[model samples]
Target: MTDSVALWFRTYHTAPAPRLRLVCFPHAGGAPTAYWSWARELPEDIEVLSACYPGRQDRLGDPYAPSVHAMADEIAAALAVLAADGVPLALFGHSMGSVVAHEVTLRLGAEHGVRPVRLFVSGSEAPHRREREESAAADDADFLAELRQLGHSSLADMDPGLLELVLPSIRGDNGWD
Candidate 1:
């Protein structure tokens, strides 16, 4: 994989000769590690590539993407390199990731002349139906409440320092400061 692609994608397993590549995008404040198990669960002929957004995990020092469209543009450029390899790609995304994946799909087709074979989205509204209004929690307490409501109670048990680091990405993903 090219260095540029490596910056945005993480591969947990190496497929000897992949028939297809499945690129996964995680939810808001999610990391590439979320899809790490897919490499073990799916057929060996399918390589799994997960998006590793900035400001988390290995890219912790990088700034969070200014917007989802910006994130998609960068991801599309990186995936275009993989598309050039002739292996068919299938995208899977959950929650906020679904929007980013949708944008990347459009970019790959329009800018790179690459069309993914399949696109699977979960837990997100239709791209065109998304509202532009702010949806982020109003404050730390509200953010924690939202996380709990979404079944992310585990985050509540996280180290305070770690939670502090994560909140920014979550808020950023939801289009708030």
Candidate 2:
């Protein structure tokens, strides 16, 4: 990937000549680091690349993506560069990332002439089944409650300052202002 495209991804393992590239997208409020361990678990021939959404982690200073389509556009462009040499790709995503991944997959095929070998998604409904009106909690209190209710109790226990810094990205990802 070029230096410009590199900003959007974090490669945990640098394969000498990867047989395949596995691109991973994280859930809302998540960072690329969430998939870091996959680098060690997967075979050396499968290089693991994780998407790093802006406004969090290393990209903390950057603006949050305006919309899922915007995220998909940028991600698709980057993946096109990565796949230009014909390295096969497989996409994996969870929750909100699944939607982004699905969009990226479509863009890759239609706009870039690249089709991923596989798309593995979990913790999200099929793209067509998603409700357009659904959104994140209305307020911080409700958001925290929702997180806990969704089995993200760890987030509820996070330091208040840290949580504050991460909430905007989470809310933005879910289509909230």
Candidate 3:
């Protein structure tokens, strides 16, 4: 039997005999598609599982997670169920996802007694090095400008049609409002 929540994952390719599973957590305003190609790019020994948070893309009908911690806790539970036999697990995160991955790692260890083979963080600062960036407090234009300064021009110039589809999930990811 297969896990239902695990089925929610998106992968660009599949490896029938993967040595390990590399679970990817996406950045803010990100979706499972962000790492979909990894399923093909990585070696056959690695199975890339890209998580899709709810209220975005095909999962739009599902309720959004209230906070990063809540999201992490939930995913950790799913991972525990999916883990079996000798299949090793690892995590990778980018931007806001780094924080989510870190929290999930902690939760898996504390609550489920599961430990990932490794935790890889990218495009984000360490917990002690983080500060509340002011852009979240800024108005729309200012926020876009701030994001532009951070080299996220896509956020500043995204098509209105796409923005309408993703903005709410982005706001949920950032815990805005």
Candidate 4:
């Protein structure tokens, strides 16, 4: 019965001299801080805005999306506000965020009439390419094992105590699907 809130995003102030902006979406169980270093690495002309979904880190009390669509909607709204300056945009997403970014890009194009100039997707394939299932609801042991198999640095390298601390929010959000 956890209440969900809007997703969070971080705007890294770049030179802002370019006509385009680049928005980055995080993978499942990821936070904005994951890409903090990316901002400094990107070209100065392409402003970088990294998305940080709720229910983790600073937003630990918020609820994560129960489905991919829900996650997309949350991201779209946040991006709408952050990218409202009318600059052309490009999207980059990895893993779970790739699908969310695709959905959001579609919504932004169809609903807001804001079409991104390009989409850079990694670590995930096209949406219709896979079956949708409640894979996250698998038992914790198996789920953790699966995450390990997926090569997530956070989960794989986490100390038991920190993993214990962070696991609930991940499990809660993952179980929703």
Candidate achieving the largest lDDT: 1
lDDT of 4 by residue, 1-177 (tens): 012212456766565476777788887777767777877887777777777776777777776667777777766766666557777889988887787789889988777777889999998868779556566435767888877776765687788898886787666546644
Ranking by lDDT: 1, 2, 3, 4
User: Model 3, 75-111: lDDT tens per residue?
Assistant: 8888887775557889999998898889889998899
User: After TM-score superposition, what is the CA distance of residue 59 in candidate 3 from its true location, in Å?
Assistant: 0.8
Q: After superposition, how far is residue 142 of candidate 1 from its true place, in Å?
A: 2.9
Best by TM-score: 2
Off by over 4 Å in 4: 1-7, 16-18, 136-139, 152-157
TM-score for model 1?
0.91
User: How many steric clashes does model 2 contain?
Assistant: 0
1 against 4, candidate with superior TM-score: 1
Clashing pairs in 3: none
Which window of ten consecutive residues has the lowest lDDT sum in model 1?
A: 130-139
Candidate 2 lDDT by residue in tens digits, 117-150: 9999999999778777664568889977876887
Selected candidate, larger TM-score, 2 vs 4: 2
For each candidate, what TM-score against the reference? 0.91, 0.92, 0.88, 0.83
Worst 10 residues of 4 by lDDT: 1-10
